[model samples]
Target: MTESDGERRPAGELEASVLAALWSAGNPMSAAQVRAAIPQPLARTTVATLLIRLHEKGVVGRSPAARGFLYFPVADSHGLTARRMHQELDQDHDRSTVLARFVEGLGPDDEAELRRLLEGGGQ
Candidate 1:
């Protein structure tokens, strides 16, 4: 199905929506709650499946609820982003080159902040 049909969405879009919902909720939520929170018109089962996949990927955590489960994001948005950056860095063999390129791509302020962090001035 195409996006116009509302039945289909771009890859990872639903998952991102679900994660956003959970993050905004600031608490574990049932699949039904998540489905209602997200803007997408998805079935509760679909949201549950997305939560399960996120759990498998270690992106979300779940606890047994009275019915099935309540899901929550394992980390805040920034933490997840940093984890993804580490995962990307781990994929490459030439760590120094990747680090250099990443540092080179930073703006002047970001570069200075990184330098300060590296110098143990910022945490």
Candidate 2:
């Protein structure tokens, strides 16, 4: 899955995996723990890269422990999702076009759920 020289890779799935591992762990975890949690056994460098990216995104919280930085999700799954979405929208761009493309990618159940939420149907 290598790309052209120096192009950034997509980190969404990697970030999601690390966040889920942190949530399930019930405590802060190191990159090693995150790598272990990943079913396919990703490289430690990969997990570390994901952690660094997540930290840069402000979604991963860190603590300076005796060993080193321990990472944890800054928000619950839904909150993190909303935060990431809002963060993306906050970037300078055509908001309507970005949102329209996002909505267009949704499946039926997801679209319906999004509509319900947008319509103030959920808590």
Candidate 3:
């Protein structure tokens, strides 16, 4: 959905957009730069707030800039996905069940790839 719809978006969606802008940039960007890069017409302050929140979450890192700060993702997309997976796993007490169900849900190709990785074949 577009921000023009005047609907409140989930914080995660906003954060993901901010991250996409940063990743595309491949360099630290100021809030204004991020705002311009994103498809959504968010205010500079809103972009800055999202960057600050991402920094707090360890998803992004920042450096002092002449105006405010330049934000960049701490990891690439795949690394972030892995980190999220780990976070989800860490939250559940029944890790074995969670992992089992996760493996069960995988398609054949993904299952083979996972098995290969598990057997240290990918290394």
- Residue 90 error, candidate 1, Å: 0.4
Q: Which one is best on TM-score?
A: 1
What TM value does model 3 have? 0.87
Off by over 4 Å in 2: 1-10, 92-122
All models: lDDT?
Answer: 0.92, 0.83, 0.92
Better-scoring candidate (TM-score), 1 or 3:
1
| C-alpha-based local distance difference test score of model 1 | 0.92
Q: Residue by residue across 1-123, what tens digits does model 1's lDDT show?
A: 677775557649988999999999999999999999999887777888899999999999999999999999999989999999999999999999999999999999999999999999967
> On residues 1-64, what C-alpha lDDT tens digit does candidate 3 reach at each position?
6775778888889998999999999999999999999988888788888998899999999999
- The total of clashing pairs for model 1 equals 0
- Write down the RMSD of candidate 3 (Cα, Å): 2.8
lDDT of 2 by residue, 1-123 (tens): 566555654567667778888899989988887889876557788888888888987888898867668999888999977886798898947999998899999999999998998899986
Q: Quote the lDDT for 116 in model 1.
A: 96
